[model samples]
Target: MKIYDAPFIRAADRYTIEQGISSADLMERAARACSDQILKEHPDIQQVLVICGTGNNGGDGLCIARHFLELSMPVKVLIHGHRESGTEDFSHHLRRFESAGGICESYSGRLPDIPQDTIVIDALFGTGINRPVEGTAATLIEQLNESGKTILSVDMPSGLPANGIPEGTVIHAHHTYSFQWPKPAFFLPENAGYTGSWSILDIGLRADFPGHEHAWGEWVDSSFVLPFLKPRKTFSHKGNYGHVMLLAGSKDMPGAANLCSFACIRAGAGRVTLADDGREETRDEIMHLHRNKLVPALESGQYNVFAAGPGLGRTPSAHTLLKQCLESFRHPVLLDADALNLLADDPSLTMLLPAGSVLTPHPGEFRRLAGDTSGSLEMLTLQQQLSARWQVTIVLKRAYTCITTPDGKIYINGSGNPGMATAGSGDVLTGIIAAWMAQGLSPTDAAIAGTYLHGLAGDLAMKEQGGLNIIAGDIIDHYNSAIKILRA
Candidate 1:
């Protein structure tokens, strides 16, 4: 799914309104969908309190309240502004709701004593909000948050910017039912608290409306990644998959190398070679080359892809190895863990990076690579800047991993959970990306697909292991299952 900002959404709404269907009809469609979903999800909702503003969003709430009234459920509307001052659609819905015997009350300075079981619908603001919420609006939002009741927001949480970071008081909604498409702000980690769990309510807008505008980024899901996954042929041999050379593992942190190697093999790499300093208890299937042999191996051109860092320490020798790898490998390499740390330590090594190289950095590592920022939005800007400057793909690892390509396209992975936050998980990601690159995927496709599959594997693991004790190895264990689901 393509992510659109406020302007694009508004344009799409206007275009939708221009396409024969009246704005009121669109509002009714959106309201009916939301009300139906709410009724289905919360069948026991005895009372609903819709806090409405003086805009179209408020109109949606009014229509929803009327639907509830028709069903013989007790519903009330608390209008923040006077009904006469509302928009044409808002006034229309308000009059219609009132005619249907719906009870409406003005929002005074104080909130009424809301029952714990009553569902509160927040329709005070929508995606068009561009300024900080203040005065009575701010107070109402704060009070609603404090009410300890389930709050469902219409279109957007009041005071939350559609495209940028929240500046002031925003409604902390339990869930937000977005109309047409999801707002770009919903994907940002900074806005996660305000958005909670959001779902897009399709209002039957014109499909071609977004084609006229540019999308901020793509929401990476199964459908988005299905095309990138190539089916295996019956006649293909092991060599057809491609060989991956992994320069990982140190004496004390040997588990990183093992985890990465296993994950690479599991992700469908035909061959995996590990360059390490004679670590004990190495896997039998993995070919090993001494640390000194890495330079010669890079010159040999036998490997299709290269991945470094994992357990590689930040020692002088490690720096030398990284420097040598950068100087020798002309192809795109997957760098993570200490490799990224080494680059942050010595800024000049970044220049040596091959074009289209993939850098997977967790927040701490990203802060080191790109200068520290105030929040996720600024960090995203810096991520994009660094990607353009270095001409590499930067996978900023997080709960929602963001992949920014050199060409300025962003892809956000919507998979994985908190369970994948364990140690060595990034190493597993590095292995997966390396495996994809080795299998003939371009640096960009490999990064996006690998991130998606890595997260999906973690999700699968979470389903079985219940996400509490899920380790990095567990993600690797479910790699094939993830692949099967994607392939199917």
Candidate 2:
């Protein structure tokens, strides 16, 4: 699941073509893959409205139209855009369709008066779009979106950029089938409106070529994140999986500490110690040797993998606990929630953080610490500044959770559905990250793996039950399953 830049996709095609897979054959494979998926899920669909252009993209639409016609499905192919000549594949398919007597309509100005029940196939602008869609193509995509029918987009939703934020007109596809690899824009948050549920269709592009990069950002699928989580040996010792000193929970918020502690234990920390706000109720949940809850208990002879925030209440005492961890904790720390709120209140606390500490904050928590954003550009600028100033990995939790490294590489996680937006969820993530740090994973790997696993767990949970029953406990329960799947 290597996500590549638009250039890499083009380069991949060149490599394939060099390997004797002609452009036409490649187009055939991609189109057939789309047709295969469509027929598998929508056998009853008829009267497909495929809007084709004159490039290789139109070749894909024409190929699909040709396939459907062969299946005895009545498909009306609407060809648009003028070209002196089309690609060899497009010309080949155009002749084949006419020879088969399939209904074909060519239009450059006005779209055909097709039936509203038609399942529209948008292939006018694939991932090759470098500029804003204009003229009839732009208007047609907008009309298709408003048509209230099942719209399928080829490669990518038209007009969405290959990598960063989308710029102009985009076909809001019910489903987008990409060829071989995924483009970066597929994972961006703003594109959520245009790019609906998408799947990458393997078109026989050889993986023998170079793999894709984070140019499109990280996809939190099992294939991408699992390698970072190696198998633990049966002969492994407690010392082998490092001890985690966790500082979370506040007075009544003791449950936050409980969640982080429970999650850390489940996530495979060799030994867990919690330096929580020493409260009566908080002490009740501490399981002595199993869940250490005291400053003295965290005086491990060895270094610590600390996790702070979670159920930590917003109080003066919570502030003291965070400053202590920031100043003294010798190992990498995972900071979240109230701990971040404390840093927001006290600017000086930023200097106290040890290098390599990882901060995980949803957008609100981030704004409070980094200050209000003037716009989207400022939001990204602030995230970059914080990572540089603290010399720590920053996980700005958002629609597509991003993991920013000290050196400034942004890895956007592609796991977890909307079901993960629940209470105490951040606590679970805190524990998961701490466990990874304890297991000797670098802060960068831990953050990336933790976010991906958390989201994958949520996705798996959502599949069993709808996204509504999603809870923090459900994430914990599915954590092992996610790890196991990644291992497999």
Candidate 3:
């Protein structure tokens, strides 16, 4: 799904109106979607408290209250601002709700008595908010938060800005129901507290709306990636898939190399070669070359892409080997773990990186390479800038791993779970990306596809292994299943 800016949402609404769909009709569609989801998810609740403001979002809340009343559900509706100072659609909905016998109290700057344990429906503000929330509304939000009640926000949290970090007190919703698309705030980690799990409800927004094609950021989903998958030929053989070289593992962390090599094979690499210090156990399928023989191995044209840095213990020779790969290897290269640390120690080592290489760095590694990031938004900006500056694709690993291309485009992955956060996970990712690169994917496509597929494998594994018990190897084990799903 394409992630668009706040203005595009407004433009979409306007375009919908221009296409002869009444604004009131659109409002009803949005309200019904939210109401249906709420009813389905919280059927056992005895009462609901709908907190609204004097805007279109409040209008949505009013419509929801009417629907609940129709369903014979007990609900309390409260409008926090002037009842007369809202959009025409809001006024119309307010009158319709009142006519339907939905009692609503109007509050200017003070909140009315809220019933205990009632699910709170927050509609105080939406994506149009540009400043911090303060005064009576902020006080109301604080009280609502302290109420220990499940809060569901309409469109967005009441106080979150569409683009910037939340400025002040915000409604901490258990779930945010966005109409048509998610705001940029929903994806930033700093705002995760305010914008809990968000889901987009399609309200018949036109996909071919003017200017829709200009969106730069995208949410990587199955539809977005299925086109990138290259089907194998019936006559294909092992050599047809291309070879991958992985430089990983050390005396103490040999398992990292093992996990990476195993993942490469599972990710469909034709052949995988590991160049290490010969301290780790090797799989029969992966050819091992001693660290001293890596130069000759490269000269043999046996590898199409090179990946380094997982579990490579810090040493002078490790740095030298990484430097050699960066300077000598012309094919796509992947750098992770200690390779990132080496570059952090000597920033100039980044200069030796071939254009279109890939770097997989978690937050800590990213901080070492790009300085401190105060929040996810700051981290994202740094990711975009550095990827563009270095002419390399950087996969900044997190809950929603973001892949930034050399041209500065960002793709936020929508897969994986907390269980996949265990040891050697990033190494598995490094291998998956290298395998894709070896199979003729560009560094950018490899990073995008590899990150998505890796996370997806983890998600599939988490279904049976559960998040807490899931390890990196579980993700590797589910690679075939993930590919099966993707191929489906």
Candidate 4:
């Protein structure tokens, strides 16, 4: 699904309104969608206290209150501003809700002594908010957060900007039901607290809206990656799938190379050659190579793709090996772990990287490669800048792994669990991406698809091991299951 900023979202809304549906009708659609989801999810909601503002977002809350009221459920509307001063849609919903005998009151400096079970619906602001929230509104937001109530936001959390980082006090919603599409801020780690658990509520926006063509980013889900997978030919041989050369693992960290090689094989690499010190246990299917023979192997041109860095240490020998790989390999290489660290140590090595190379850097590695930034948003900007300038695909691995390509397209992965944070997980990711690249996927497609599959595998592992017990090998073990789901 394509993600849009506030302006694009507003434009889509206006285009929908211009397509014959009145703005009030659209607001009703949004309200009904959110109301249905809330009621379905929380069937035992004892009471609802909608904190409404003087805008269309408030109108959505008013309509939602009316739904609960019509069902004979206890509900109340606390308006931050006067009804007469509200927007046209807000006034329309307010009058209708009042006609239905809805209890409406002005929010004073203090919160009401309502039942603890009441769900506070935040409709004080929406995506159009550009300035910092202040005054009584800020106080109300803070009080709501401190009230220990289950706060549900409409469209957006009151003070959080739809596109960038929040500047002032924002409502800390336990759940947010956004209309049409997810806001860009929803995917950022910085706003995860404010948008506890968010879902997009489609309000009948035009499917063919032109504004969607210029989306800021995309939500990478199954549908977005399904097309990238190709069915295997019945007559194909092992060579048809492509061979992968993995230059990973140090004498002390052989587990990294083992984990990476296993993941590469499991992710469908026909052949995997691991270049290590040869002190670790070797799998029957994997070919082992000593560090001394690595230079000659690259010159053979037998491997389709190469992945370096994982357990590679930052020693001078490791540095020479990385430089050799960069100088010898003509195909796109995947650099991760200490390989990225080496590049950080010698900035000039980045210039030696082959075009279309893939760099999987966790936050610390990314900071070292691209320099530190203020926050995730600034880091994201830097990620894009580096990808464009270097002509490489930078996979910034985190809770929501962001894959930024050379063309400036950003893909936010939506399939990972916190359990995937274990050590060796990133090595597993590097292996998967390299495997995909070896199988004839373009560097961009390989990175995107590999990221989605890696996260999906982690999610599958989480199902069996639970979040706390999951380890990196668990992710590798579930690669087949993840691929099956995508193929299915």
Q: Residue 255 lDDT in model 3?
A: 89
TM-score of 1: 0.98
**lDDT (Cα) of model 4:** 0.90
Error of model 2, residue 251, in angstroms = 2.2
Q: Give the whole-model CA lDDT for all candidates, comma-separated.
A: 0.90, 0.78, 0.87, 0.90
What TM-score goes with each of the models? 0.98, 0.88, 0.96, 0.98
lDDT of 1: 0.90
Q: Write the per-residue lDDT of candidate 2 for residues 363-443, one digit (tens) a residue.
A: 899889888976544676678778987899999876678777888777778788777888888898999889888888899
Which residue runs of candidate 4 sit more than 4 Å off their true CA positions? Answer: none
lDDT of 3 by residue, 1-488 (tens): 88888888888889988998899988999999999988888778788889999898899999999999998888989888788788898899999999999998876556666667688999988888888999888998998888788999999999998776987999999999988876777778788899888888888988678999877588998787787788899999999887988899999889899999999988889999899777678788998888898877776777788899999977988888888777767776799999999999889998888889899999999999999878888889989999989899999898888889887788889888778878999999999988888788888888888899998899899887653658888889998888889988
lDDT of 1 by residue, 13-129 (tens): 888889899999899999999999998889889899999999988999999999999999988889997778999999999999999998899989889888767999999999888
Model 2 lDDT, residue 420, Cα: 80
Q: Where is model 2 poorest over a 10-residue stretch in terms of lDDT? A: 282-291
What are the RMSDs of all candidates, in order?
A: 1.2, 3.3, 1.6, 1.1
lDDT of candidate 3 vs native? Answer: 0.87
- What digit string (tens of lDDT, one per residue) describes model 4 on residues 114-221? 797888899999888999999999998999999999999999999999999999999999999988888899878889999999898888888567758889898999
lDDT of 2 at 299: 53
State each candidate's clash count. 0, 4, 1, 0
